[model samples]
Target: MRQHFFRCLKVKITKFIAAGMVVTCLFGSVSLGFAAPQPSPITILPIDRAKFVSGQLFDFLIEVKDADPDRIQVTVNGVTADKYFGKGAATDREASLATYRINNVAFKKPGKVEIAVKATGTAGLSTRTVKYDVVNPVAPKRAKNVILFVGDGMSLQARQMARILSQGITEGKYNDLLAMEKLSNTAIITTSGYDSLVTDSANSASAYATGHKAVVNAMGTYANSTADPFDDPNVENIVELVKRSRGMATGLVSTANITDATPAAMVAHTRKRAEQNFIAETMLDPRHRPDVILGGGSRHFLPLSTPGSKRTDNKNIIDEFKKLGYRFSGTKSELLATPPNTDKLLGLYQLDNMNVYLDREMLKNPKVLGGFDDQPTLMDMTQTAIDTLSKNPKGFFLMVEGASIDKQLHAMDWQRATYDTIELDKSIAIAKEFARKNKDTLIVVVADHAHGASITGTYHELDGKKGREAVRIYANAGWPTFADNDKDGFPDSPSPDITLAVQYANHPDYKEDYKFKAEPTVPAIMANNKAIANPQTSGEFYPGNIPSSDPSEVHSADDIILNADGPGADYFNGVMDNTEVFFGIVRALGLDGNRNVK
Candidate 1:
C-alpha cells in the first residue's frame, strides 16, 4: 500500500512540472518578441541628403553617443569609406561621444551618393545613412565682374524706413525709389543655416561665399567636434576659387571691422567669429587673400605693444601687409590719396567699428567719433574699392557690406539704423553707376538677415501725448514729417515733430520712451549674465522675451529681399535659399569647380 501511494505522488509531481514548462515556454516567447531599446541618435554635419556642387570640398562627419571608436564602421555607397575616398577616417573621443570624420572629401562625379555609418558599444548599436546630390552644370554666358552688396540685417522694413526719410512721401506717394528698389530682379531670400532657423552674419555670408550652409559663427568651413577654432575642415570660398581658377582680383569693404563676420566670410575660415586677431593674421594668406581690404578694427592689426591694440602677440599685421606690397591706409584721407594704380590696398579706419552715417557724415560729433573721426563714408569706400579693383584687366569681385545697420538695430536705435540703410543705398547707387558704365558687372544687393523692427504707423508729441500713448496706427497715422530739406537724401533730424513708430517684434528687457536717444545707447545691460532693462532710462518697462544671455535685440528668421541687375541677374527672381546667391555669383562669373590646380 505504501509503494502505490508513493507512485501516485510522483505522477502528480511530474504532471505539475509539465504544466510549469508549458507556461514558461508561452511567457518566454512573448518576452522574446519585445524589441530592445534604441541607441541614441547620431549627428551628421551638413545633415542627411544635403546637396553639393561637384568637386566642391566638404567634411563628412558622423557622431555616435556612448559608442566605442573601434566598433564604428563607416561606408560610402555600400563600400568602406576610407577605401572609396582614398583617405583614412579620423576618430575623436570626447566624453561619451565618438566622432568619425573624413576631411576635404569631394564627389567628383555628378550624381547621388550615400554615406552609411554603424556604431556599436555597451549601449547597443546605432545606424545612420545620409545621401547627397552633386551637380556640375556648364554655366551660361558669364559676367566679367561681380559686385555683391550685403546690408547686414537690412530688412524690408529698414528699406521702407530709408525710403520714407530719403525719398519723402507726398499725398501717399514717394518722390523717388532707392537705387536698390530700381533693380530689375528681386527675390525673397531665406536665411537659415544647418544648425538653426535664425542665422548670424557669419554663416549667412558663408552661404554666399562658399555655396554651402554652415552653422552660426562659422564661415568658409564646417563646424567640427573640436575645440580649436582654426582646425575645422575647410571649403573653398569665392575668393579662393576665383583666385585659383581665373586669377580674378577680389576686394572686401564694410562699415564694420574687416575681420568681422560678413567681410571675413569672403576669405577667412574658422569655427568662431570672435577670433578677430587670428582673422587679421589669416588675411595675409596668399591663397585666399583680398587685393583690397578696407574697414575698421585696427586694434587687431596693431601689435600688443600698441596701447589700443587688441592682439595678444607682438606681430603687427599692418607692417606685415605693408611688406606684401599693400598700400596701407589708416584714415579716410590716406585712403583717398591712395594711388588708383595701387594693386593691393589695406585700410583700417578705427580702433573698432566705424561710426554710423548720422554721426560720421552729418553730426561729426567729436565724442561720438572718438578721435578716429577720419573714417570714410560707405559711398566713398565703395567708389574707392571699385576704382582700385576695376584696374584688374581679368575682372574683379567686390563685396560691400553696410554692417552697422545690424549693429544699430541691435541697440534698438531705429533712427541710426535708417541712416545706415540710406548710406547703403547711396553705396548701391555708386555700384549702379559703375554697372551702367561696365555692363559686364553683375550687381547683387541683399541682406544677410532680417531685423525685428517694423513700421507700425507714426508717432507724434504734438497733441502732448508722449511715450506709448503718442503711437498712431492705421488711419490716425498720417505720413511721417521727415524732410530732406537740403536734398541730401537724409532727414535733417531723426527726432522730428512727427516720426515713424518703428516697433520691435522681439526684444530683451528694455525701456521704451517712444523717442530717439541722442547718443548710441544700449537698450539693455548685462547684470549677472542676464539681460536687464537699462536702469539709466525712464520709460515703459518691458519684460524680456529672449534669453538672458543676450543683452540686445536678436535676428529674425523672416525672409529678406535680394535685388539684382546686370549680367546673370535673371538667376534671381523667385524664392531662393541663401546658398543660391553663391551659385548665382559663380554662374554669373562662370567659375569652374573642377579647374585643375597648377
Candidate 2:
C-alpha cells in the first residue's frame, strides 16, 4: 500500500511539471532554471577642472545606485583602500543606495588625481573614473605679516564719493587722493559666492579668508543634507591654519557686534550666521580662539540672569577668558590702562553694536546713544588692538572692519554714512602708518559688497521750492558751502543752506521733503514678516519698488575694487575671484603645506 501511494505521488508531480512546461512553451516563455549574477552599480563624475593649492583639504563623494553600502569599493589615486572613509559609509539598504564622504584628503604632489569607484548588486554593475588636476601654488618670497581691511558694503561709488567729500575735487582735479587710492596695487574683485550673484557679508568674507566658495549666509562650511547647522563639513580657515602652523597671533576688530558676520567668519564654522550664541562660544574655544578679541556684543557672552545677557546659560565667557589668562576690559579706560605686553586681550565695550562715530564721539545724541554713554572710537580700538597683537614675535594677522557704513547707508542717512567712511579712512591711516614702520606687514583694503549710492551732482534747498523741483543739476548744480575750517576732517553740520539733495535711484515712491533728518529714520519696517515702507518717516505715502521681503536697501551685484600694498600685491589686479585674496595673503605670509600640515 505504501509503495502504491509513493508511485501515485511521483506520477502526479511529473504530470504537473509537464503541464506547466507545455503552458510556458505555448506562451512563448522559457525559464533558464538558474539565478542571475549581480552587477556593479557605482560611478564617479570626472573633475575636469579642480582648482586647489597643494595640501588644501577638499571632499570626495561617491554615489552608488541599486547596491548595498557594504558592497561598494573605493580607491584613491589607485591605492587599495584598507578602510574607506576611516570607518564606513552611510547607506539606505532597502533603497539600495549609499554615500561615501571623504574629508581632509588632498594630493600632496601636484598631478592628476584619478578616482575609481565600483558598486555591485543583484541587478547589475556600474563603474566610474574621475580625474582631478592638482596645480601647485606660487611659492612665497619675502613678506611676513598680512593685514586685511574690509569696508563693509563699500562700493566704487562710495569710494568716489568719499574722495569728493574728503579731498574736494575742484574743476575735476584740485585735491590729493584718499589714502586707499594711493595704494601700490589695485584690483577689481568679483564678489559673487558659489550660490548667487548677490552675496551677503558672511559668505563673501569666508571666501576671502578661506580659498573656498560657500553659499549665502554660510561661513567655513558647505551646504549639505543635514538638519543640524553645526554638523556640516568645514574648510580650514586662515585664523586656524595660521595659528596652528606659524603660532601667529590673530585679532578681529569691528565696530559692529563681535559676533557679526564678517568678524565671526574668521573662527566660527556654521551654516547660519544668526547663530550668535554658538558663535560666541566658538570664539572662546582654545583651538580656534583669537588672541586679541576687541569689539561689541558682550550680551552674547554673559548668561540670561545677568540682567543684560543674551545667552541662555551662565557660561560667563568673560570669566572663562579671565581664567585663560586673557585681560578682559569692559570700558575704554580699562582698555587703555591694560599693559601693552598683555598676551591675550578681550575687550567688549557694549551689550550690542557700539554707537556710530556721529552719535558716540561727535553728536552725543542721547536718543541714538541709548545710555551706552562711553564707547571706544574706531581709532581707539584699532590702536589698542595693534598694540596688543604686535607683541607676537612670530607676527600677527589682523582684520579690521568698518561695519556701520552699510547700516547708515541702508537707513538713507548719507551724512552718517560719510562720517563712518571718514572714520574707516582714519583707521586705515593708522594701519598704513604701522605698515610703513614694519615693512613686512602686507595691508589690503576692500569691501565685501556695494550699494546703489551715486553722486547725481549735489542738492541745494535754496530754490525755495520743495521735492524734486528743488533738485540741482548741471551748471545750476553749484557747489554747496561746506566749510571744515577746523580741518577736523568733518563738516560741523550737514544741514547747510545748500545741502546735498541726494535722491535714491531706487526707493519706495514716497514724497521728498529734501531735508536732512534730525534723527535717523527707519526707511522700512516689518509687517507680517514682509518689508513695508516705515510709517515712522515724515513723508508722503510711498509704495516700495523692491520685493516686499527686503527690509531695507539690498546689496548690489556690482564688482568691488580692492587695494593692496606690500609683497604679494601684484597678484590682485584687473578682474579676479574673491578666493584669490586668500591665496595672495597666504603667499604673503609664506604659508606652506609642509609647514602647516599636521
Candidate 3:
C-alpha cells in the first residue's frame, strides 16, 4: 500500500547487531543475513558493513539507552573516538537515552575499519563492534557527467505499461523500446531500507545519494534516539562529495515539489521527509546547494506574506536565489526564454506538485490545475537543467525525477501514472541525446520504489460486457487500442476501447470502474472512522485487500529495474542492493572524498 507519509518520528527499538558481519566490496549494507543478534543497550549509527567513499564526511553516533552518559566509551579500532579523529565529540544526556556524537568525520584510507562502543547501564555492560569499508573509486575512463533519473514508484509493471502505450505491440512482438530500456547495463535493485521491509522514497533515495540505508521518513541522516529530526546522524551525500571534493556542478529536477523526498534527499539531511520548510531553506546552504533547481512547490520559496506561500517565515527564498545570481522562471514560456548561456537557475512552475502530463498537456483544463496553470514538462525542465549545469567545466550530477508516477498510482490512476512514465522516458531520451555527444556521461534510469499495479489483460466492451466480464485473459485479450500516431511517444488518448486491464496487488477499499478518470481522484475516501469507496465512480467494489486506513494502493517491496549506459555503466549487472547505485556513480565519476583536513 502507498505508505502514509508519516510526519512524526517513530520510536525504534533496535537490537544493535546484524546477523553477522560480511565483507563489503562496494556491494551494499554490511549485514547480509536475516538473523540479527540479541538486543544491546547501545546502538550505533552507520550499522555494520556500511561502505563509504573515502573522505566522505559522516557523523559518528552511539545511542545509549538507560545508560550513564559519562560511562560510555567509543573507539575506532584501538584508539578512542576523539583521539582517533583528533576532534572532540558531543555527548547529550536525556531522561532515558544519551547520545555521543562526532560530526563531520571521514575515513582517510581505503580499507576495512572497525568501531566498537561500550556503555555502562543500570542492568550491565553493553558493547558492540561493527566493521566498515572505505574506498576510493577509480576508473580507466571516468564519467564527466552523471544524470540519475528517478522514476519514483515506477514498478516493473509501470515500465511495461509505458512500453505498451508508447511502443505498441503487434502479435506479442514490440514495435520499439522506451529510451530507458535501451541502456547498456541493467540490474534488479532491492528497495527496502534496513529499518523495514518496504521503503519510502526518502529512505530509498538516501541509499543512492549516500551509499547508506536510512529509515522511512528520513534521508541523508540515520534515525537518532532523540526527538529532534535535524539532530540525526548525518551522512554526506553525492552532491556534497562532487561539489566539495571536485567542484562539480549539481542539479535537481522533478515533477514533484523540489523539496520533496526524492530530490531533497540529494542534499538535505532530515529524519522526517515531511519537513519541507526546512528542506526549502537547505537549498540555500552553500556547502551542498545545487547550481540548478527546478520543479514545483513555489509556495515554500515564497514569503509567508504571499498568498499561496507555505512558509512560516518572511524570508523570500526566490529573491534569495536571485541575489545569488540564479535566473528565476515561474512559467513554461519563461523557462524556454532563458538564455542558453545561463548557468545558475531556480525555476518553480507551481506552488505545489506540478500537474501530471495527462492533465497539464493532454486535458489542459485550468480548473484541475489549481490556478498555477503554466507548468513546464519534465523533459523541458531536464533540458534546461542540463544546459545550465553542463556549463561547469568540472562536470555535473543531475537527478531528474518523474515524481507523480507514485502519486497517481497511490490514487489508483494508472492511466495518469503511465502517461507520466512516458514523460520520464522522453526525458531520458533528452539525456541520451546529450550523452551521444559527451561519451563521458553516465546515465542511470531507475525507480526509487515501486507500486503494486500490474497489467492483467485487456478490457473491451465490444462483446457488450462490462467491468470484470470485459477483462479478457490469454488469447482472448487482444492488443490494447492505444495508438501514438503523433509519434511524440505518448498515446493520443489515455482511455480507449480495448484498454489494458490493470489490477493492484494490494489496495484499500475502493471501487473499480475500469475506466480512465477525466479528473484525478482517489478510489477510496474516509467514511465514519474507516476508508470506504469514494462513491464518485461505479463498478465492482474491491473490498480492502490492504488496511482500510490506507485509502489507496500501497508500495511494493518487490525489486525494480535499473538501466545505465556510458562510463562506469559496466559496474551494474546482476542483482544489487539499492545503496550500490551510489557506489556506481562515484566509480563512474572517479570521485574520492578523501581529503586532508586539520
Q: Estimate each model's TM-score.
A: 0.90, 0.85, 0.93
Q: Candidate 2 residues 33-149, lDDT tens each?
A: 333434335534213243455665545555576676676777867774435335444444434456656666555666777677777766666677666665555535546677788
CA RMSD of all predictions: 9.7, 13.7, 8.7
lDDT of 2 at 89: 42
- Please give the TM-score that candidate 2 achieves against the real structure: 0.85
lDDT of 1: 0.88
Q: In model 2, where do residues sit more than 4 Å from their true spots? A: 1-50, 58-68, 71-98, 111-140, 505-514, 540-542, 596-598
Return the lDDT, model 1, position 361. 83
Maximum-lDDT candidate: 3
Q: What is the TM-score of candidate 3?
A: 0.93
Predictions in order: lDDT: 0.88, 0.75, 0.90
Model 1 stretches astray by more than 4 angstroms: 1-41, 66-71, 91-96, 123-125
Q: Model 1 — which ten-residue stretch has the worst lDDT? A: 23-32
**lDDT score, candidate 3, position 187:** 98
